[model samples]
Target: MAKTKNPTLYLTELDVTRLEGIASRAGTAELDEMLDALLERAAIVTPDQIPKDVITMNSRVICALEGDAEPREWTLAYPDDADLAAGKLSVLSPIGQALLGARAGKTVDYRLPNGTAQRVTIVEIVFQPEASGQFTL
Candidate 1:
């Protein structure tokens, strides 16, 4: 069988810290392995320069699917108590991780737990906080 390709991930200091916290709390080597794998995958996806469409860490944006009637808005940050009530999803989730930093019109293939591939297309980016003139950091 062929090996699966992993993409390089561009994460902010905050996300890195959070991942470290998860590793510490779990008391397992999963986090470390994930980080290593993420870096390797990122290298493959971003061999040259990262495309303009890739989302940065802490980005809040509206992502629309090609076939979906409405766009879904989400942030990369772990939602707070209030945000959770508003339908915000954590970036660590399978779907969130697949969509992170992905540009509009790009086809993203995410592997499901059952070993199936979920293919999605980024139709329109209605809004992106990083693309806008908000916090630069």
Candidate 2:
């Protein structure tokens, strides 16, 4: 895989700490790579410094799959909180990693395990924990 410039990703200190632990224990090469990529590109910040428009854990976001007009909504969440039927996306998923720290109006690109490049655009942060004063979440 070629190392390319990734979109600037901002992550809260809490999120970074938690994710680091998760990454350290990752069992699969694919998961490890994705976690490492997320950590490498993240710009750690305080909870209060997280942008209201950025997609953080527990943030419900609306996005568009590149080339698709219909928008899909999902809540970026921890592995334990993820339930696809509920629209809760796990940070372990390729799409979830790509969306982390992405702000509304920005486009992020990530490659699938099969090496297929996918682009997703953040349309809106419908509900961000920090924006709602729930920073601990």
Candidate 3:
């Protein structure tokens, strides 16, 4: 993690449960570290109790990368559902980790493959599963 202050994270209970299993089962050090950090900092809430402004699993959001004119659209997903062509981003991915639990207007930072930090602003949430009353399990 960078020295930047981490923003408050709000994760649905269901998302936390599934991601906890993934963190334990995956057994990758990087994933474990990131997941642990995120989980530890997150405020777990019920599906219906989650705020509409927070990004939960399967949320479709528009992010504006620093210095980029074009904003990108992404749907946060689990690894199996990640499809770049379909704009589905994996929660385990660097960017996805930052996107998860972030609120609208918050800026998230992630490191690129080359170890350079990149920033993206959570400009708008086009859709969120919880907000739409789509509670999966």
Candidate 4:
């Protein structure tokens, strides 16, 4: 896949530290690559520096998939916390990785399991843990 210029991703120091450990222990090359990509393009920041509108771990967001009229709500989370039925999306998942650090009103492009390119727009960030001063979450 060709690398495309993406908007700068913002991540908290705590999140980065945890995700780096997860990435290092990842069993799949795809997961490692996804984490690398995210880290490569990320602008690491302190929890207090994170913007309120940016999507962070445990943040509930509303997004519209490309070509889809209806917006879907999801919570960006860790692999162990992922529960599709509950709308918790794993950061290792394509859509989850794509939404990381994205601010409301931004759009991100990602690849599907079938290798199809798809885009999604962040319509709103309903809940951001850091934004709410819940940095430990």
For model 4, which pairs clash?
none
Error of 3 at 115 (Å): 1.3
Question: Pairing residues by index, what is the TM-score of model 3?
Answer: 0.90
Q: What is the TM-score of candidate 2?
A: 0.86
Backbone clash tally (model 3):
0
Minimal lDDT window, size 10, model 2: 1-10
Candidate 2, 1-137: lDDT as tens digits? 21225537788888877887777776678667776777677777788888788899889999999888799999998998899999999988889988888889999888888999999999889999988889898
Write one digit per residue (lDDT tens) for candidate 3, span 1-137.
Answer: 21124538888878988997888888889877888799777777788888899999899999999999999999999988999899999988889988999999999899876898999999999999988889993
The alpha-carbon lDDT assigned to residue 105 of candidate 1 equals 68
Residue pair clashes in candidate 1: 6-41, 7-41, 7-42, 8-41, 8-42, 54-101, 55-101
In the range 10-122, model 4's lDDT, one tens digit per residue, is: 88888888888887777678767777778787878889888898899999999999899799999999999999999999987889888988889999999989999999999
Please state every model's RMSD to the true fold in angstroms.
6.1, 4.3, 4.2, 4.3
lDDT per model vs. reference? 0.54, 0.84, 0.87, 0.86
Best by lDDT: 3
How are the candidates ranked when ordered by TM-score, highest leading?
Answer: 3, 4, 2, 1
Candidate 1 lDDT tens digits, 1-137: 11235544443333445656765676767656755555445432321233446665455556565457786776555423215446565555566667665666677777766887676666665555445544333
Candidate 2 — which residues are off by over 4 angstroms? 1-7, 27-32
